[model samples]
Target chain A: MRTSKTTRATKAFEKALATRPTGRCVLRLYVAGATDRSRQALLRVRKLCETELNGEYELEVIDVYQQPILARNGQIIATPTLVREYPRPMRRFIGNLSRTAGLIVGLDLETKGKGAV
Target chain B: MKNNGPQSATPTARLPKCPTGIRGLDEITSGGLPRGRPTLVCGGAGCGKTLFAVEFLVRGAVQFGEPGVFMSFEETDAELKSNVASLGFDLAGLVRRNKIVLDHVHIERSEIQETGEYDLEGLFVRLNHAIDSIGARRVVLDTLEALFAGLPNEAILRAELRRLFRWLKDKGVTAVITAERGREQLTRHGLEEYVSDCVIVLDHRVNDQIATRHLRVVKYRGALHGTNEFPFLIGEEGLSVLPITSLGLNHKVSNARISTGIPRLDAMLGGRGFFRGSSILLTGTPGTGKTSVAAYFAQAAARRGDRVLFFSFEESPNQIIRNMRSIGLRLEPLVQRGCLRFHAARPTLCGLEMHLATMFREIAAFQPAVVIVDPITSLLAAGADFETKGMVTRLIDFLKGGQVTSLFTSLTQSGHALQQSEIAMSSLMDSWLLLQDFDGNGERNRVLYVLKARGMAHSNQVREFLISNRGIDLVDAYIGPSGVLTGASRVAQAAREKAETLTSQQEAARRKRELERKRATLEQQIAGMRSEYKTEEAELRRTDEQVGTRTRVLTAERTELARLRQADAIRAASRTPGKPKPKSKR
Candidate 1:
């Protein structure tokens, strides 16, 4: 089931890479330390941006253990939190990137109905 | 007992405390909250939970010299600073001095999405950073329950909270975690399950339409704390938990005496007055001069240069001043001199606890040597009977603790048993003066007598409490066939007795004069009788002399005839017999 879901996500990412970017996406990933979850979240977010947005995004990774002021400024309470600072209304995604569907919907990368993305 | 050893008896076995420096709170907690452990502070809305948390941090930083970190999930940095500024806590100054660090952690659920399991590692890192920056020894997470609302998963949030509390403990920072009070639980999100070292519950209850805030230590692991709910107040200074009953009867007693302003009343009270640092209960019916007696006491104390704080629940300060002026008591000068202060408020202005808190605040601020509560019974209108009694007990205890002489005037109902009704508080008083109205001669007059004066040989005689324009004068009430005659009846009784004495004196004088006149008339009659007897006796003497002369002549003639006849022998014998008879007569 996990493999099939990944394949489906990859196919959507390929379809999104075929179109030009409509708007720039500003993302900030806040993590506590160099933990397994932080690494997984960073990799997942980087891969998603590279594939879905096709380099139409600016991603900043912040380690709360080192740069806690940024985390505090961003109102980060949960570890491995993904904050979308641009594309108009701001949104945050909490937890590791084990589930990509919620993140897609939060980042406005959902290609279900709206065609603006 | 767990057989902890001899140290347990020496206080070394008890939990080390981190003093919050809040007034009366340290007394209730037996020092303060458990040191270096997470304490859960739960309360309902507007119950001063945030203030408690803020005060804990501010006091920890400013007073105890231990830096603190305040991570508020609800209010921002500026908001928290301004909110606590009214309490006189300079949060900004503390932050600038590196004694405190204010970090606001806001989480809006509407702008967030949760996909999977996550921990509160970000919060821990932020707290760690803030604490490390200032080397803070105390941490406060005010209203940490906001996380439950912000996060989507409760199980994970609860797990993370457990870990966070443990982490706080490992960090060796005394942490205060405030949460919302829940129905049938200590906290809304069951935060008490974690942070179980100590749990404090703040309650704001409205009794008889008056709101009062109370604090109770619900749970304290391995530490002793006051379990009873203590009334607390959020005043200009800060939160003060009143552990009034805990004051006990251990206050120092003073042998010094203060006058009651009325000379005769002082004479009645053992030729001096009430003892310094003693609680005096003055109970009377309405219009029976209770307030007058209290005012006199206040004036007396003020005259002696002792500050007097008058708590008038029945009348305003101006009204009291005006009324007292009618009795020739000039309190305006004492008030102006700052020796006498009047705090007047209606009984229904607040709850008994609030009233008590206000009184405590006033007493603390004024630092008066004498306190007068005019008509303390008015406070009963704002609370239950037992509650009022408790409040009075606490007030007396507090006053006694400060060595402040207190006089409490209680207004009793006209027909209720005075002593019986006052029995609730009478035991707590060191001296009790009962002012009553004697109804006779178609008028009611005030009478005062000391019902009980502990450790003093007080007068037992009832005194007529006269409130004239000259002031209170305690005159000896007329005690006669009518009990305790006062007012016009006493004067009338005195006048009647005087008139009776005068009439009896006049009757005695008139009878003596009549007796003297009768004796003089009798003496004159006796003198006249004596003169008549003297004249009769003189006439009898003259007749006897004439008879003797006639007898002498007859004898001479008989002797001449006998000699001529020459009968010498028989005549001589007769003459001898006559001579013997004459000699016998002589």
Candidate 2:
């Protein structure tokens, strides 16, 4: 009922992969207000998730101002924190999500060579 | 941030302080933590750092009418509330009244990745939301270092921490950040580098198998604070800090006197008793009735309708009360009447400071005019001699400052050894009474001598201290060559001396009667000899007179015969005178 962070993340990823054979990638991006850095991080992360996963992913953008509880629960420290919640392992990129090449490898898209899309 | 709104009603100019409302802490902090500044509290595990930070927030809300927000990175809201529930701080009620906000941030380091340079905007947002929701004037980040432990990237954590302090100050909210102490530095993750306005260190350790909690204000930016390690206590009441150094020697001196319960003992102390509000020390070897004397003093105070707080370290209250009843000192009635309160505790249970804190609290709550500590020597087990001395010195100052007369009993190893500790505190006492056992003629007896009494001409004579059903009595000691005699031996010596006096007196009476009888006999003998001599003189006189009468008769006859003869012989003799030549022969 109250599992640790690693176990819960593993179980959630397994459930998602079993439900969708295409291997869904669930991403959540937490940011402060509509600042330049937050907007830039949101644009890059959404473009990468939507293009590589090709409708096999769910992207949720959260502004810490209107809903700070979720941001804190997600352990979002930086202004623009992008978290890949599914795909067997959760990875975080805290900058403006710049360097799409590294973001792609970090998201496991390189291992599949964008084949899941 | 400086706008004069309801949220920013904290005065800006009044020393820039936030009073924590903990006993003895505000006095040490020179008010409290730096206002609207991030103060760091760091300690080892279970050292009371979190509790200290929580008390800061709770007291701010409850006492100062300022709300608070507690953001926990280690424990959940339920855990924090349950932990503080024992102290009677109704955290749930406070939260319900919107005076406290608890936002427990669940941070798992492995699940989150640090991509690049980032700021803690989400934490800032949540904290801002909590503060604005309840108009919190105080904020606490309990074990913020736990986040660094969870998040591996120390560089980013360190950078954001530096800015977080400034942000809290800019928001005009006094913040307390709890952290774990590093092995070398003040904090494990060096959080002190960021929250540097004020630093408090809490420590818990066991020495001689006795646990003691200590608090030290490591640094206060602009205010002078107590630098010494103060002993603190955590109990159902709350954390109480006890400062070892007395504030100053500014206590008022009282010249009024009170009785010592024993009338003769009072007489020894210049016909009255100890000066009111003065410290009195009772030192003696074991079983010398030191506790008894202290109890009598307490009873005397109770008899005057004044309250007394009796702290017994070696015996339970009921045990002492029962023991006193044997000596005709009924303490239970005094307790029942609410004039006397007894607190019995083992000195080894905690460190000396905790004991001091508890006593300070109890004294304030009871507001006693008199206090008695029976066998203060037991406290030595909790600390070294110097530590115990420091504790007693502070106690003496605190009690004297409150105008409360305090009586203390100490067990010394020997009558004259005067345990250096005993002597150390005796120097500060206004009166010192020494009780000792006088072993003479094979039995031990209690003797009391006033070693010193300030400002009064006290009697220096040692008195035999007696305890019986009638009560305690101090009688002049029967001083002899062996020493001051006491107990059955003293009574036996008195009886022996009394019998010797009677025998000598009877011998003197017998000699006087014999001499009187001899003088009367000699007078009778003289009277008998005088009467015999007088009779002899009478006999001699009568014989001489008879002889004279006979001779006169015979001479007359001869003369008559001679005259007739001389008329015939004087005519015979006178005739013999004619025969005178022949009468010359006649």
lDDT tens readout by residue for model 2, B96-150: 9999999887776666555555677878888988899899999999989777766
Candidate 1's C-alpha runs over 4 A off are A1-23, A112-117, B1-4, B7-12, B417-421, B482-484, B514-586
CAPRI grade of model 1:
medium
Clashes (backbone N, CA, C under 3 Å), per candidate, total 0, 30
Q: Indicate the residue-level lDDT of B435 in model 1.
A: 86
> In candidate 1, residue A51 scores what lDDT?
76
lDDT per residue as tens, model 1, A1-117: 999999999999999778745678889999888989898889988998987787989999998888988877888899899888887578988888888877887776777314533
Expressed as tens digits, the lDDT of each residue in A77-104 for candidate 2 is: 6668888888666777777766666677
- Distance (Å) between predicted and true CA of B175, model 2? 1.5
Q: Distance from true position, residue B2, model 2, in Å?
A: 30
Instruction: Point out where model 2 deviates above 4 Å.
Output: A1-26, A66-75, A84-92, A99-117, B1-14, B244-246, B480-483, B496-586
Q: Quote the lDDT for B217 in model 2.
A: 94
